[model samples]
Target: MRVLITAATFRSHLYPLVPLAWALRAAGHDVRIAVQPSLVGDVTAAGLPAVEVGRGPDFMSELKKSIDSDGGTPPGTAPSIDKIVVPHIRIAEAVVADLVPFAKNWKPDLVVADPAAFAAPAIAKAAGVPLVLHTWGPMPDQLWADLTSERTARENWPKDLVAFLDTWNVELGPDYADLVVDPCPEELLAIRMAKRQEARYVPYNGAGVTPDWLDEPKRRPRVCITWGTTSEFMGPEVLRPPLLAIEALAGLDVEIVAALGKAGRELLGDAGEQVRVVDWMPLSMLMPTCDALISQGGPGTVLAALVNGVPQLVVPQISAQPLGAELLTNSGAGLTLRPDELTAESVVATVTELLDGDSVRPAARELAERNAARPDPTQLVATLADLAAGR
Candidate 1:
């Protein structure tokens, strides 16, 4: 079977699908990732074959522009969904123009796409293939539905576009997809969509070399502090949590490993000797040894900590992170602190609690067990194959 996996031009969006892409290839299916030209490097870096499609206004730049125009929302405040979805719709329109022709020529049997890869439904319709929506976590279903309706009318898109999507079981009116591959634990989800297939959240933080120190046995409880790669793209003011977290953890008994981009390091200059700062380290390789995780509430970091059964202190900085953090807190796996609520003392207190608390760790372990009970990506290959075969 031939599988075409599509994602927008973001590493966070692309990484979630990597394990599934690998699983399909390992199962003897032909797999190729279709992404905006800017993201080809990221896709190839993950050892997947990448096909660059349509070039135009980049999604991140447009989103940053919107944020700049809005004078920036406070930390932990989600921007209006249209601010997030409109740029994606524009990009998708461009990508679909290019991708439809490519899909016709390549003739993929199935199309697995990120939920925001708005081009996929049309491409799948054009090629007469099954479309699968792969979600990173809980999505704003009503927000997406509203955005799609508003955009379609404003762009004067064909009324039959939604009808064509319906042929594949996609209902844009309610933001339903033919099938959804969800990697989140059931308890954390706020809204459950129909035709959901559960998959384990596998950590894939791109390729990186593991340092020798990481392999050596730890002398004390190790806590990982990270704001994730996206933090680097923002201004310094947006990244106060990592600095506060470092200060909070500095005098603690635990060993701290801080993963910050060069920019982040510069902003939080002279992290004391108590903190070990690296420009990048694969969390998948590093989380196993950590007693707790302190992060800016990026989904990848939150999910990585959960899968590793590490209790977390989440200081959400932007969209979805706040909700993700709250879900973790509600699930008994972690705690959430808004940026305004964050302080060195508060971070220290939370980290200490995560390390010493019994309920949080056990709850994290239970979430991990629930995640593990979901079907592995390799196990999902047959389901995709069956979907491709129209079973």
Candidate 2:
């Protein structure tokens, strides 16, 4: 069987699909990733074959420019349709022109895609293949509603998208896929959903080497602080909160590891000996060694902490994070602080709770058990094959 998976250029967009790609290959089915030209290297780095389709600037780099100009979309809130969703739709229009020709020639049996990849449905339609929708992580219930909202209302679409739809010959719809493979924790996603296939959240931190710090024994409780990649590009001001967190966490006996990539490290030079700041540490490799985490509420980052049984202090920066952070806080697996609520005192208090509070540990353990109980990607191999075979 041949399976073609599609994603946009962003690593956050591409990484969520890696485990499934690995699953398909392990099961002996041929798999290929078709993405914008810039993302071809990332597709190959994950050991998956890549087919480039069309061109676009690095998605996040473009977004960064928008954010810098208009200011961020307020921490904990989703970006408005114009600022966020429309750009993606525009990209899809460009990529599908190239993607459809490849899909026709490759003749894949199944098509899988990240939520942001609007081209997948059209390619599936063109090839007469089953289309699978994969989510990046658990989303806010309201955000989920926005994503799954009314389709087939083509007349209501913005004029530009309407034209794009006509050109692509595919109707505008939320999640235009036959099967939805979702990896959100069930408790975090309580809203009734359609065509939902629950899958485990598996962390893919890119191909990485283990840091030397993991080799040393922990002399104290360890806490990881990370801002994922988007915040790094949003501007230097985004690093302020972590720097504030460092000040708050100082004098505590805890060891701090801020895995803020190279640019983040360069922005924050020498965070003292007690604070080990490094670029490019994988959360899947680092989280198991830590007792707690502080991050800007990215779905992948939050799940990485949860799956490892580590409690967290989440400071939601943008997009779906605010909702996911709220759900995590409600689940008792973690706590959330919105942009307005961030401070040195707040950061210190939350980190203290994660390390010393009794409420968080038991919840964290239970969430970990639930994550482990869910079928991993390797287990989902037969399911994908069955979907392809229409059985």
Candidate 3:
């Protein structure tokens, strides 16, 4: 079988689909990732073949420019749902034009796409293939509704596009996929929007060498602090100023691993020995050794921590982070602090609570058990094959 996996031009969006892509390839199916030219390297780095389908203005830069002109909030602050979906719709429109021709030529049997890849439905329809909507986290039906309504009016799309648009109109449903592959735990998910296939959230934070220190037994309770890779785009200011969390945790008994990018590391000046700052390390490799995690609530990071059974203190910076944080808090697996609420004192208190408290870890363990119980990508290959064959 031939499969085409599509994603928007972001590492976060692309990474979620990696496990399944690898699974299909391992099962002897031909697979290729269709993405913007900028994301080709990311796809290739994951050891997958990539097809660069579109060319145009850079989406993230345009989004940053729009955010700056609006002056409503800082760069990393979460945008309104309108802001989130419009740019994606614009990118999808450009990509789909290129994708349709490629889909016709390549003739994939199945199309697995990121939730935000608005072009998937149209491409799948044109190619007469089954579409699977794979999510990094919980489905945001409201955001999809807003996006579809705006696109339907603005694009005045053709009849083939209507099926995708109609998906947004339906209540409590997935947006035009034959099957939905969700990685989030059932308890943490906000809604079940489709006939679903549950997959465990396997962390793939790019291919990297595991550090020697990661294998050594820890002398003290370890806490990982990461703002994720988006911090490279948003700049260091996206995190709390003056490195409040690191400063506050200075005197604590715990060892702090600050897995910051170059920009984020530069923002921290002369931190104490207790804080070990490195530009990049795989969280999947690092989290299992840690007692707790302090993160900006990226779905990958949050789920990685959950899978590792580490309690978390989430300081959401933008986008779906806040909602993810809330769900984690509700599940008793973690606690959340809004951007405004983030301070050195707050960080210290939260981390202390997470470290000392027994309830959170037990809850985290429960969530982990639930997540581990879900089928791995390798197990789901036969089901996807059947769907691709129109079974």
Candidate with best TM-score: 2
The TM-scores, one per candidate, come to 0.90, 0.91, 0.89
Off by over 4 Å in 1: 65-78, 141-170, 173-175
lDDT per residue (tens digit) for residues 252-329 in model 2: 899999877776788778778889988877788999999999998888888888889999898887666777788899
The Cα RMSD in angstroms, rounded to one decimal, for candidate 1 relative to the true structure is: 3.7
Model 2 residue pairs with clashes: none
Among all windows of 10 consecutive residues in model 1, the one with the lowest summed lDDT is: 153-162
Q: What residue runs in model 2 are displaced by over 4 Å at the alpha carbon?
A: 56-79, 140-159, 166-175, 190-192
- TM-score computed on alpha carbons, candidate 2: 0.91
- Colliding residue pairs in candidate 3: none
User: Per-prediction RMSD in angstroms?
Assistant: 3.7, 2.9, 3.8
How far is 166's C-alpha from truth in model 2 (Å)?
Answer: 5.1
lDDT of each: 0.80, 0.79, 0.80
